[model samples]
Target chain A: METTPENTAHGYIRAGDKEKLRHRLRRIEGQVRGIQRMLDEDAYCIDILTQLGSIVAATEKVGLLILKDHMDHCVRHAVERRDEADEKIEEVVSAVERFLRV
Target chain B: METTPENTAHGYIRAGDKEKLRHRLRRIEGQVRGIQRMLDEDAYCIDILTQLGSIVAATEKVGLLILKDHMDHCVRHAVERRDEADEKIEEVVSAVERFLRV
Candidate 1:
């Protein structure tokens, strides 16, 4: 595991994952800036709420990506380490619930 | 971008961050298992609520670590790229709100 790349987008980020995350985050970024401009321009409350919801959804996607990576790497490694892996799994399960509930 | 070491704990994880994160997660993992046992033993409602609160706090700590990484890497990089970095900052701001609100 000492051969991981640094910044090739494939190094720390999973293959193809960086592109997807970047694309989504870029969009979210735009939506957020738009919201700020809207607020500056005094847009309606419902409009702002709608934008907030979209931002929330986008943020959730980011959380999911990280969650997937954690499961694939951290949790899986723990499972191979020993029988105590169940505890790790439970932590992840509870985390997912919190993520989704938000 | 291409020099990140793989699995050295320093590859993706910040020098000291992994140790801290792992330690915290280990403790949280134990707490979670204890919660399961408490539930199994039919612990009182307030007891369960307190455990849930602790779990939530632990989760928030994890989230904060990730947020720090994102700001130090992703947001800072975006800022160097151009003025559009403000939007990225806003996205992170909103995400923090969502994180804390939960």
Candidate 2:
């Protein structure tokens, strides 16, 4: 939302992406609640496990979306400006490692 | 709640653990909603990712708890009864692989 390198480095996602991300998160919350309902209803454990995997995968997709946005906008801007590009790249790499479970 | 080898393989979790698992899941739902609010407030992306990481970690913990319960009750019961022990073990291994992201 801000138009400065400092805000970019400080790390907020693009404003346009915010509502979409929030929407995904709301769905994820519903999924979690669904799993709880499954448990209460005595649903099969394997079915619940499958649901859990999907939830995790969905969450990672949201994360990847955010991470991708950063690369597309913030990091790219930093590189174009030649301003703190190294720090930006390093921060993103660390985030990638965390997401990858490395 | 029901007892018989068929019900076990069909995969309902143990009665006692259901409440606890549901409690954990409720907490996770809250966490996911918390992240949504964070986005709405324009929190830092790294902070959001960190929050995402914790949500994944907590969800996996719930999956693990269910898996462990299956191992302790269903699988062990199968082995002790010599009733489809191989199938139970195979099912659990598959679940473990899914959980471990293999």
Candidate 3:
């Protein structure tokens, strides 16, 4: 039902996970801002770096969740259709590679 | 010269690099908040996931910068001091493992 991306082939987040993802993102956003504030206040490099580790880990976790949902729903659907199975598999592989590279 | 972190031996960000790190962090903060806002407005999952990738990469990049600075200053200084060389090496190795794990 989403129209903003101009297509129905994307944005396939599961309904239940959407709210959970939103909450996580909001918290991550706050943590990012908090780091900036720490910098502005001249926080320690070690502390800031430590905090940054947490952010990266959190963001990575969120990505994993979305990736799982994609596989569970969208990817599963595509596999069932067989029409876009290769494309979907390739896409998910690429996504996993990106996450791994980080 | 920072007093809050207490007793020094940390917060060793180089003077020249502090502002740069701060600026990068500020932009990253905005990007994070933007993702949250996107969700609040029903942004697509694929789109959000893509955006999340960027955040993870950017945050990782910032962490690398801080790590480099830490090595160049703090770790290097420790290496010069025979007393703390092993400790600093272990500390840096631990940090690297953490970043790599993420």
Best by lDDT: 2
> What is candidate 2's lDDT per residue for A35-76, written digit by digit as tens?
987776667676688789888988988998888887887789
True contacts kept of 1: 0.00
Tell me which of candidates 2 and 3 scores higher on DockQ: 3
| DockQ of all candidate complexes | 0.02, 0.42, 0.44
lDDT of 1 by residue, A20-86 (tens): 7556655655664564454344343233444555555555555566567656755676799875599
TM-score of chain B of each: 0.70, 0.83, 0.86
Model 1 CA lDDT for position B82: 81
lDDT (C-alpha, whole model) for all candidates: 0.53, 0.79, 0.76
Sorted by DockQ (best first), the order is 3, 2, 1
Off by over 4 Å in 1: A1-102, B1-13
The total number of steric clashes, by the backbone 3 Å criterion, in model 1 comes to 7
Model 3 lDDT at residue A92? 74
State candidate 1's DockQ. Answer: 0.02
Best of the two (1, 3) by DockQ: 3
Q: Which lDDT tens digits does candidate 2 get at residues B1-102? A: 223455544555766678788788988998899888877666666667777887898888889888887788878988999999999899878877886688
The TM-score values for the models, in the order shown, are 0.41, 0.83, 0.81
Tell me the tens digit of each residue's lDDT in model 3 across B49-89.
77788898899889888889878977788788775889768
